[model samples]
Target: MSDPILKARGLNKRYGKVTAIDNCDFDLMPGEILAVIGDNGAGKSTLIKALSGAVQPDSGKIWLDGQEVAFASPNDARANGIETVYQTLAMSPALSITDNMFMGRELRKPGLMGKLFRTLDKKAMEDFAREKLAELGLMTIQNINQAVETLSGGQRQGVAVARAAAFGSRVIILDEPTAALGVKESRRVLELILDVRSRGIPIILISHNMPHVFEVADRIHIHRLGKRAAVIRPSDFSMSDAVAIMTGAMEPPASMAA
Candidate 1:
């Protein structure tokens, strides 16, 4: 693969006696879905948090496009074109899709109204939001002004992903995006993942569902004991094999025998 768009080396984080991450190394190739899998407490979430700037690692170096950098907060990561959509989606339930998309980074009115009164550019925000949602095939939304709380689980997921795709210029991190939905809804989200990847944005997916991981991930990053155990291609490892590796019931393939 070409130089990874995102790379990390020697990442470590600890919470008192518990070590959340242990000298981990990671990479995300451009335009590939890299699924991260592990058993409970395997530090998968911690690794993501560190990458997303939700938690500061004790020690590590991160490189985006081969330039070393540090993220002080989630906003810092977002500014650098790394967006994360957690399980909760972090959206205001009562707000419209347009409002949710521009919650913090809202556009303002032009001239004196923007300077003195500080009014928002609602039309511009709505137009952009509608375009993004439509790109994701979310035309079921009859009105962009409809409150997010009125949407179904799958539609809600679509909205969250659309918001990410609209902003995430480099990479998008999805954490168990299908955890709570039914099979059909889950499929919808999986399709959405592929749709996002098709647009040339690399995705780092953290999921426990082996089937979902297998279906969408181009490569699998098996994490165990707070560190990366192996990085394998989907074609090289079966679902059961990936599960065994993640649970430490089996060792990595012979290629990792070194």
Candidate 2:
């Protein structure tokens, strides 16, 4: 196995003595789907936020592809090839699909038009968005110019994932990608996740759905009491075993220690 593409050591975060994350460590290897699972208030979101630059850790070390980095903002993470699609999706409903895809990083036209006047190259952005959507088998969206508000829940999720896939070069972090979808829609999003992994980008999937975690995760990182309890292969441990470890009902076996 290769070294971790994303790595963290001794991460700690707190608010008024309420520890959100405590001495936590994390690793995301190349081209793998790692699921971070825990009960509510388990500090999963804080760990992810720290990684994605949404929240700063009080103390920790982070490395991307073996080079240490400190991300002060989400854009800092994005510039370092880390993109996060929050559970909220963080999109403008009234914007066109193309616009939403290139929301922060808009493409500018060539020469003085782009350099001086700062004219956005709509055609280039549209073409690139269309190509990425098609590459991801998301052409079912039909119109690249359609307003995001007019799309279905699943379709909206698709666009968000597509945007991440389009620009996220090293790692893509998904926060509960299927939390709001119907059964069929959830299935579609799951397939989309596999499709993204197929393209050689590793993903950090944060989800609470046990069946979904067991279904797609190559390895499950169980969070308990503000830190990682264990890392286990889904095949090596049953869902009930994971729940037991997560809730402090059972200890993780030696073979599955993180």
Q: Going through the candidates in order, what is the number of backbone clashes in each? A: 0, 0
lDDT of 2 by residue, 1-258 (tens): 999999999999998889999999999999999999999999999999999999999998999999999999999999999999999999999999999999999999999999999999999999999999999889877899999999999999999999999999999999999999999999999999999999999999999899999999998999988899999999988999999999989988877666
User: Best by lDDT, which number?
Assistant: 2
Scored by CA lDDT, what does every candidate get?
0.91, 0.95
TM-score each candidate: 0.97, 0.98
In model 2, which residue pairs have backbone atoms overlapping below 3 Å?
none
Error of 1 at 216 (Å): 1.0
- Summarize candidate 1's per-residue lDDT along 75-146 as a digit string, tens digits: 999999999998999999999989998877899999999989999999999999989988988877879999
lDDT, candidate 1, at 219: 90
The superposed Cα distance between candidate 1 and the true structure at residue 25, in angstroms, equals 0.6
Give lDDT for model 2: 0.95
